[model samples]
Every structure is written in C-alpha cells, then in structure tokens.
Target: MDLEPIWLSIKLAMITTVILLFVGIPVAYWLSRKQSILKLVAEAIITMPLVLPPSVLGFYLLLAFSPNNGFGKWLHQHFSLQLVFSFPGLILASIIYSLPFMISPVKAAFSHLPRSMAEASYMMGKSKTQTFYRVLLPNIKASVFTAAVLTFAHTLGEFGVVLMIGGNIPGETKVASIAIYDAVEMMDYHSANSYALILFAITFIIVISVFVINRNAVKSPFE
Candidate 1:
C-alpha cells in the first residue's frame, strides 16, 4: 500500500548506477588494458561480489560500520557519517553489490574494442583523456549503457544486503524489495504480489530495452 519504498528503491538504483558509471569506467578500463599479475587479484576483488552471498557481505559490512568498530567510529568522529541503518548505508551496500554488474559490461566493452583505435589517437597527438572521449568511448558506449541499466535493475532487487545494513526504514532504506519481503511476512500475499509484479515489470522492460538498444548499436554503421 505504501509507495514510499518503491520510490526509495528507484532513487537508490538511480544514484548507485550514476556513481558506478564513473567508478566502473576507470576500473573497467584498467582491467581491460592492464597486464600485470596483480591485475588478476584486483579483478578478482572487484568481481568477488558476484559469487559472494549478499548476506555474507552484508554481515561483514554491518560489523565494519558498527559504531563500536574502529572504522565506523572514525567515520562518525571525523565526518559525522553513519553508514549503518541509514540511506547512506543502503547506497554503500548497493554500490558494492552492483559493482560487477557495471564493471563487467564496461570491461567487456573495452576489451572487445581494437587497441589500434586508441593507439592511433595517441599517435595523432591526443591525450589519454581525449582518446577516451573521442576515439574509444563512442565505439563502446552501448556497453556502458547496458552497464547502467543492469546496475539500476540489480540495485532495485537487492534484499539481503539492504536488509542487513539498512533494516527497512520507511522513506529511507525501505526499498521495494524489502517491502515485498515485509508484506509476505505479514501474510499479505496480495501486497507482496503487487510489489513483486511491479518490480518484475520494470526490470523486464529495462532489460528488453537494453537488448534492443544493443542490437541497434551493433547494427548501426556509426557504432
């Protein structure tokens, strides 16, 4: 019945996807190009969330953000930022949980491109930044678009991590996933089905849109 949770989930997904675009781009670029042995370790770290259970990650995060813990204490003392049981906590958890969704697509995008494009740009007196914007990004923009949509959808469906860290706080951390969970717990199948159906519809449409756009991009001569 309360729509606040749905809006909150949308807000969380949007913000998380936007931030991950910037963060994931650089990381994905690095992973795609770097050849050092340490790069393997770094990639594993970034992709760890994909295999790790959400509740496991959430449990550790909860401890890491507990006020009694050193890191949490430092955060509160210096920046007055409380990560546990707050909107900020949900953001942080979602970011971690959704990192691979954004990064993998971007990495694939960059990896699939020809190195000659970047090399030619460098030879033509373009800086790395310029090469990225002018020569590289345009060719692979579809992957980035895919990453954004995937991240948004993934964040919207999060439950265990958000629950462990944010605890279903209405108008704040109580996202649609949590709402469905609560509805089911209260023996309200209708409410649960409504939220679930809405989430499914939104995610389905987003994914279908991404596939359509990707196909078009691939078919386009400009791409």
Candidate 2:
C-alpha cells in the first residue's frame, strides 16, 4: 500500500469536516427557522448532492473550475491559485459533496429543539450568536458529532467528483478511493481487497460509534 493516497484522503476528509462545521452550523440554523421560498430553494440545493450522481456534480464543477473558463482564469491570473488538479480543488469538491451529510443532521437537531428556549434566551438579553454558542449549540453535541463523522466518512469514500475534478495524480489527487479503483482496474484484487477492507473497517467504526454514543448520551440541557 502506498499509504500516501490514504493519508491524502484522510487529510481531505479532516479539512472538509472542519470547514463544514463552520459552514453547516449557520446553514442548518437558518434552514431550521426560515419560512421563505428561498429557504426551500436553498434546502433543496443543499440536499441535492445526496441524491444526485457524483458524475453530474463533478462535470459541472469541472467546467466551473477549468482554467480556460472565466472564473477559473480570473483566480489563476489574480492569485495564481489553481483548482483544477490540486488539493484545494479537491477540498472544494469535497465540501460541496459532503455539505448535506453535515447539514441535515444538524438541521434536524435544531428543528427538534424547543423554540421557546431560543425565545427565552433572547428575552434574557443574549444575542443570537452568544445564545447559539453558549446555550443553543452546546446542548446538541450529539448531533454535531454525528454530522462531523458523517461528513468525514462521505468525503473519505468520495470517488467520481474527485476523479472528474482532481483526477488521480498520486500525491496530488489520488485518494484511497481512487487508489482502490485503480487497483481494481488493473485486476489487482488483492490490493483492491486490502483498500476496500480498510475503508469498510474505518466507516463501520465511525457509524457504529455514533449510534453507541447517541444511545448512551443524555438529551441536551437546553432541550
């Protein structure tokens, strides 16, 4: 096993999860409370990746990030930043691909929370930001953990989007999923099995641990 791809995959997942934590919090919070038509549009777009084929999303992203295109060219010209076949590109794709995994659960947790609690916090003179950090968010630690793990796992196993956007360039873009894919394409079943089994074990541990923790944990104090 080269392990470089595996490490790269882990790095992508970690960074994606961290960014989504910040991204998902506000997104989910807004979605949970908003009643506007735009909220529906936003929710549908956010969740589309869950059901959309990775290839479709990847293709659009490829066009959007192509250096020949305006936005991509502007980025390269102004900042010399390349997204087409780089780690930063991989991270961007992973974030969009994994957004729902982080947002949905967090939104569900927030939705299930009592609205009166938020109102009470507001009545007591706490700003929404302060209330979220101190009173609203800390209470939903379980959902937050579940969201992070789900996002990390989703990014770890991502393939098609990564392929179309980043391609398999070894240390540059070849993640574990791409590595296993290459091994299978070469009829290297042994290598494929090794990679597959490792991924299976890691995802299994993550998913099972979430269930175990959720079962044993108490409900949030704010709830």
Candidate 3:
C-alpha cells in the first residue's frame, strides 16, 4: 500500500485544523456576543458550506481559484500563488469546508458562558483582550479541543471538495480519501482496505478522545 496518501491526509488535516483554530476562535467569540443582523448573516454564510452539497461548493471553489477568474488572477499577480491543483489549495478548501465543525462548537461553548464573567472582568479593569485570554479561554478549553479534533477528523474524511480542487496529484494533493477512491476504481481492494482501516482507526480514536475529555471537563469536584 502506498503510505504517501495517508501521510498527505494527516498533513492536510493538521494544517487545516491549526488554521481553523486561529480563524474560528475569534469568529466564534464575536458571534457569541454580537446581536447584529450582520452577525446573523455572517453565521449563515459560514454555516452554508455545511448545508450545501459538496459538489456545488467544490464547483464554485474551482472557478474561484482557477487562474482565469478575477480572484485567482489577482492572487496570481500579487502573491504569485497558484491555488489550483496544489497542496495549499487543498488546505484552503479543507479549511472552508470544515469551518463550521470548528466554529459551531466553539460558539456554543462561548454562548454557554455567563455574561457576568465578562462583566466582572471589566469591573476589575481588565481589557477585552485580557478578559478573553485570562477568563474566557480558560473556561472553554474543552470546547476548543473539540473543535480542533472534529475539524481534523472531518478534513481527513473529505472527498468532494478535495477531489474537485486537488485533482489527486500524488505527494501534493493526493490525500487518503482520494487515494482510497482511486484504489477502488483500479480494483485494488486490498490496498483500499488498508487505507480505509487506518483512516477509520484514526478518526475513531480522535472521537473517543474528545468524548473522554468532555466527560472529564463536566465532572464535578465533589463527585
């Protein structure tokens, strides 16, 4: 079995998860506190990828990232970056596709927090950034972990978006999901099973780990 795809999938998921953590955390924080219609619209747009058919998302991304389009042309001209059929392109697609998995959990965690916590911090003369770092983040550590794990697992299993944007180029865009499909198409069930089992095991471990951590987080000291 070619281990390259498995390695690529791990690499993609890790990068996407890291990027999402940085980007999603702030958005989740804002969405949890804001009461504007714009926030609602933005949340809807972020969650749209979750609801939309993967093929539709993939098609739009394909056009948006293609060299012929305006956005793609500008990216090419300014940054000399070609997103189509590249590793960074796959990572970008995975980030967009799995964003809700990261955002929703963190948002829920933030929403569940008491408003008084922030107010109390402010009363003590803590700035917004200080309150977020010293209080809010500490209380929501579990949720942050949950978001990262879920995003990573979801990206590991991604097919439609990666296939549409990545074109299954080996060692660059050929992640495990695409590799498994390729193996099946070529009637290589043995190799396919190996990749499938590895993927399943990794995902199962992550999910189980999340649940264990969540359970511990919710446990009472007295209990």
Candidate 4:
C-alpha cells in the first residue's frame, strides 16, 4: 500500500484544522453576538460550502486562484506564489470547504454562553477583549474542541474540491482521497482498500476522541 497519500491527507487535515481554528473563532464569536443583517449574509456565505456541490465550489476557487485573475495576479506579483495545483492552494480550498464545520459548533457554544457572565465581567470593569478571552472563551472550550475535530475529519475526507483544484500532484497536493480515486480508476483494489481503511481508521479515532473529550469536559468541575 502506498503510504504517501495517507500521510499527505493527515498533513492537509492538520494544517486546515489549525487555520480554521484561528479564522473560525473570530467569525463564530461575531456571528454569535452580531445583530446586523450583514451577519446573516456572512453566515450564508460561509455555510454555502455545506450546501453547494464540491465541484461548484472548486470551480470558483480554481478561477479565483488562477494567476490570470486580478487578485491572483496581484498575489503572484507580490509574492511570486502560484496557488494553482499546489499544496497551499489545496490547503486554502480545504479551509473554505470545511469552514462551517468549524464555525457552527463554536457559534453554538458561544451562543450557549450565559449573558449574565459577560455582564458580570463588564460590571467588574473588564474590557470587551478581556471579557471574551478571560470569561467567554473559557466557558466554550468544549465547543472549540468539537469544531476542530469535526473540521479536521471533514477535511480528511474531501475529494471533489481537492480533485478539481489539486490535480493529484504527488508529494504535494495528492491527498488520500485523490489517491483512492486514482487507485480505483486503475482497478487496483488492494491500494484502494488500504487508503480507504486508513482514512476510515483515522476519522473514526477523531470522532471517538471528540466525544470522549466532550464527555469529560462536560463532567469536569471547571464547567
């Protein structure tokens, strides 16, 4: 069994999860509290990935990241970076595709926070940033953990977007999902099964681990 793609998939999922944690935290916090219509619009935009066909999302990303496009060209001119069919491009696509998995859980957690806690912190003369970091975040640790696990698992199974934008470049963008596809196309059952089993095992572990952590977190006195 070719282990390379399996390793690549893990790498992709890990990087995507880390990026989503930072990006999703702020977005989820905003969505949880913001009353503006723009928040609804933004939520719709982020949740689009969950509803839209992977191919459709991938098509837009392909065009947007292509060097011919204005934004893409500007990036290329400034950084000499080419995203098309590259590892970084796949990472970007994975992050976008897996955004809702990260955002929704964290948003729910943030929304579940008691308003009284934030008010008490404010009454105690804490700034907004201080209240969020010192008060709100500590209360939502489980949700953040849930978001990271779900996002990582979802990113690991991604096929359509990675296939469309990544083009199966070996040791670069050729993740396990794409490698499995290639194995199937070649009628290599053994290789396909190996990749599939590894993916399944890793994802299963992640899901189980999330539940375990969540259960323990819920039972902890800190909560």
> How well does each candidate superpose onto the true structure, as a TM-score?
0.96, 0.95, 0.98, 0.95
Better of 1 and 3 by TM-score: 3
Quantify how close model 3 is to the true structure by its C-alpha RMSD in Å: 0.8
lDDT of 4 by residue, 123-207 (tens): 9999999999999998898889999999999999999999888898889988999999999999998999989998889888998
**Model 1 per-residue lDDT tens digits across residues 114-165:** 9889999999999999999888888888899999999999999999999999
Q: Give me the overall lDDT of model 3.
A: 0.95
Candidate maximizing lDDT:
3
Query: What's the lDDT for residue 154 in model 4?
Result: 96
Candidate 3, residues 139-181, lDDT tens digits: the string is 9999999999999999999999999999989998999999999
- lDDT score for residue 91 of model 1: 92
Kindly report which residue pairs in candidate 4 clash with one another. none
lDDT of 2 by residue, 27-128 (tens): 999999957999999999999999999999999999988888987888988999889999999999999999999999999999999989999999999998
Worst 10 residues of 1 by lDDT: 214-223
Screening candidate 2 with a backbone cut-off below 3 angstroms (N, C-alpha, C), the clashing residue pairs are none
For lDDT, candidate 1 versus 3, the one ahead is 3
Model 3, position 124, has a per-residue lDDT of: 100
lDDT for model 4 comes to: 0.92
Displacement of residue 203 (Cα, Å) in model 1 is 0.6
Which has the better lDDT: candidate 2, or candidate 3? 3
